[model samples]
Target chain A: MPTSFPPPTGDAEAEDTLSTLGEFGLIARLNAGRAQPAGTLLGPGDDAAVVAAPDERVVACTDVLVEGVHFRLDWSAPDQVGRKAAAANLADIAAMGAVPTALLVGLACSRDTPVETLTALVDGLWAEAGVVGVGVVGGDVAASPTLVLSVTALGTLEGRAPVTRAGARPGDVLAICGRVGWSAAGLAVLARGFRSPVAVVGAHRVPDPPYAAGPQAAKAGATSMIDISDGLIADLGHVARASGVLLDVRSRAFDVPARLVDVGAALGVDPLQWVLTGGEDHALAATFSGPLPEGWTEIGTVRAGDPAVLVDGRPYEGPPAGWDHFTR
Target chain B: MPTSFPPPTGDAEAEDTLSTLGEFGLIARLNAGRAQPAGTLLGPGDDAAVVAAPDERVVACTDVLVEGVHFRLDWSAPDQVGRKAAAANLADIAAMGAVPTALLVGLACSRDTPVETLTALVDGLWAEAGVVGVGVVGGDVAASPTLVLSVTALGTLEGRAPVTRAGARPGDVLAICGRVGWSAAGLAVLARGFRSPVAVVGAHRVPDPPYAAGPQAAKAGATSMIDISDGLIADLGHVARASGVLLDVRSRAFDVPARLVDVGAALGVDPLQWVLTGGEDHALAATFSGPLPEGWTEIGTVRAGDPAVLVDGRPYEGPPAGWDHFTR
Candidate 1:
């Protein structure tokens, strides 16, 4: 356990601190007495840490969540930011059909930021990491205008071959392992100034990717895989382009979650559009050679044609535009 | 080769251009036709990249270099920033006595940023990764106020037990594998609004850690190890505290790097102070149980005493503090 410093209460009082503590002193305070996992041979005190990978193959991915661009403090708490950062990275590892083993986080925030906020952030990170059975091995914290989190996840294949986007064959069947469009719908609810249930807002804050379903799909012979981070059509297009096969989705086959439908109905929007084009759902999208695996629902099929993703045998006419950091 | 939209020639640019390009299109552009080194079984354009960790044990570390806090765009080029980011993360992996194998980067920048700048940044990243025979296997790109680079490095241990910071014992000989204080000197020069030789400024731009020396020290029986990212005294203090030993340094051992001496002379500062308290040199400092390893110079000793670093039997005070992201 790390030594805890009491956080400032209420946002009313302005504090003139941080410079008094200094960076090294604060780092010492933050890194104090945290326990490292058994597989970690070296931890925070060193320049780098060594961990046992066991399977000789490591699955690696990176994601950056920026302030205002990815999330707003007014909408989410510090703990939520930390949880979201870890969740996004871990989802990428799961998408590769690997078990997440460790994580590294890079944080940049303004000076005068409360150390309590940081501790809360770390608590959120640890909370999510605990759920996934991974550890936060190392990180760097610095000052910036707004909070920025760069998370990298490392995973072990456990002797299984990695499922990549390019392995889908022309005749493979398409399946999804988790909920789709909930985050997007949640975002819509937030944007419209509607107070949603804690569960709905929680989905928007820290997405719950179906972590167990990834390795299960790999074991069930998934040919190609990807995380639905950039909407179903957009992410599947990566599979199509990489595998050199067109993917034709039968929209009726998709099993949209009831929560998403409820939110969409209450918010007065097409839930199907969110299912097709809304991103950050982080569900696993994969192609299988045989019958759909447990907890997976068949949604489409890989077709022999030029690489593309089509809805009901036609190009998606409604925006197809997913999240773009720079232009949007 | 990524599809290049005609490079921005004028100042005014259309908004929503990023949204128009879409997330998948941007990722496709970013990942198109990039070559990766061997051992990267699956590279970008996948859910997660797969790298061969061969040794079953891997070294990993991450750091975020934020604009203004970690770097200044007015002072350093985008390529320089890219190289520095890679060097810092790779040095962390190397400091663990592991050979770096791959890197994952996460970048967040504004939409108005030029694509040429992004390409040059990547060019510099590749240039530096080539030095240690490692290549970038994966990354993420998003939008933010200023540029934020988060890099994670992976390395192989090659059957050697990692040299951690907690293993330094009394009577262990302390040695260094690379130059120290050059970066600090360069930073001082930069801060002073003065220019020196290309080498001085170059040190500030791209740090050169002695990559080969890490594994060599491990082979020679290093007991504890860390990278000189912080000033020598400050970083050694970490070893002292972790290992419960006192570290005493003799400054005469730093005669090999004439640049350190020249920069100190030019700046009218004590060269010894820079050697002791300057940082970001990426040098490896390790404690050895036997004679110093090949390519390592004996600079200090671990002794049974209070956990502190002393120079010539006294605590050395200096003008410059070690590099810190916040509260500095």
Candidate 2:
């Protein structure tokens, strides 16, 4: 029984395009060598995938990445784009104090797209999911004028209560794990048409989200947590409003990386400003009343005031107010 | 505390574009007035949503619908398009013999898209989800050149084993639980630019999947199940190959509806061909070794032979070979 569509024949170059390979062929190619994790009871090929949700609950989130809006093919490889798309949603799951279990991708691209590009992009999705021992369980593909990746990640909380953005209290201390402003610096470098600073440019390409730190924070009794996708200040604003408390960050709390400092000097931009206002780093920010978890740096505190984010006791002045899809 | 983005003000007409309302505002509008089901532990407004997976396993799948590819705004209302998109993924869940729990949508569209259209589309998503007592728990929206809706549905098996496509035996009876080829008939009329025959046209716009019949068939000891999204013969091919048995459909078994026959006669086309090869009505086709479930009509028989779908024991001869996104 031949379950797959007929294999492509004739000239190899003509068969390289998605249109030549057809939808089923592309799907078969993308799923050819992928490995499923233990949590994946059933992987791709089925109508729906079944994944283990040991905690009796599933934490799920979706993040959509448009080609021009989120990344450029010239700046990042297809694999990198795939990784970033997966990271965005995986980080969201982690922000809820959950361990990611599976990812489902929905890709819409032009018929002229190269089959190689699609395969590499899926390879990146697999690589990132492999980081947490998860699998790309299922997805759908369609033909569109532009490339769009919509990734949905599912996770389990391991029996712990989810640490939401609305749990911060007046006396809680603010802490963060993972880098900030690196992606912003990377974007600035890319905007200047210089790709020499591989560090920041790579950061902009694929975020290294602290996935394990989420469960660690929850186990350590953190009250509130959020993924820093929209800069330190803008994302904290969400927490501030959600928790009904003012969050105040210290100016000197961050130890900006030397690479960013050197790049800031060369570019005539303040690295600290990027740390305070840049986004897309996918860092974890949480509030704790007890001792901070290892690897988390204390940077601010929650206070009794109007729901707002403050820098060094007052609102910080900045033009980079974080990424807003339509506004930008 | 203002958890929502600021309410729209100024001229109502000016505030109607997605650009004017912004991403957060549009999300708020889509989420406003919608009720969450009991299975939703955490709905939108956070990094992720938590849904109850009471059976310790979750069934998940993704389906993408493009504006021009899967639908046309002029042909179908935004809400109808939304309902169809949600129905596509929800039917996949039901086909797995699972009860739908939640949905996460990923929408990418031009910035100038109408706010009303987006809201209406979401309203349709909510309307369809409400039918099954589920919620649109979380999703993401982004700016793109075209509109694309990627919906991910999660479900629970409720202690029942999933009726997969590979479980059929040689002597199983093939049955169907819903209309087939009606959407194809509607599409034929729409392609010819005639909107009259409202019944078939409406079916093309929004599918009425027998959601309960999936679980009902599973409970009746059905060996295999599949959603007929690609067409009766084409989808049956999947079951035939997966089950390693030949599926032979009896042409006399189906009583083609008079509406399709009238339309087919008017168009000088065979209505039975549409019933055999037309897709997108989202009917359930399953193989049973035991007595058929209520509402199921036996249409074929599974036999020991090379894996293939046969119309009266021979290969189906037609041009409407089911829907394939890339090839078509």
Interface RMSD of each: 1.9, 0.7
Q: Per-residue CA lDDT of candidate 2, range A284-315, in tens?
A: 99999999999999999999999999999988
lDDT of 2 at B154: 97
Q: Which digits, one per residue and each the tens of the lDDT, describe model 1 over residues B215-262?
A: 888888899888888788888888899899999998776783678678
DockQ of 1: 0.69
Model 2, runs deviating above 4 Å: A1-15, B1-10
- Minimum summed lDDT over a 10-residue window in model 1 chain A is located at A11-20
Each candidate: RMSD to true structure?
3.5, 2.6
What lDDT is reached at residue B237 by model 1? Answer: 81
Candidate 2 docking DockQ: 0.88
Specify the highest-DockQ model's number: 2
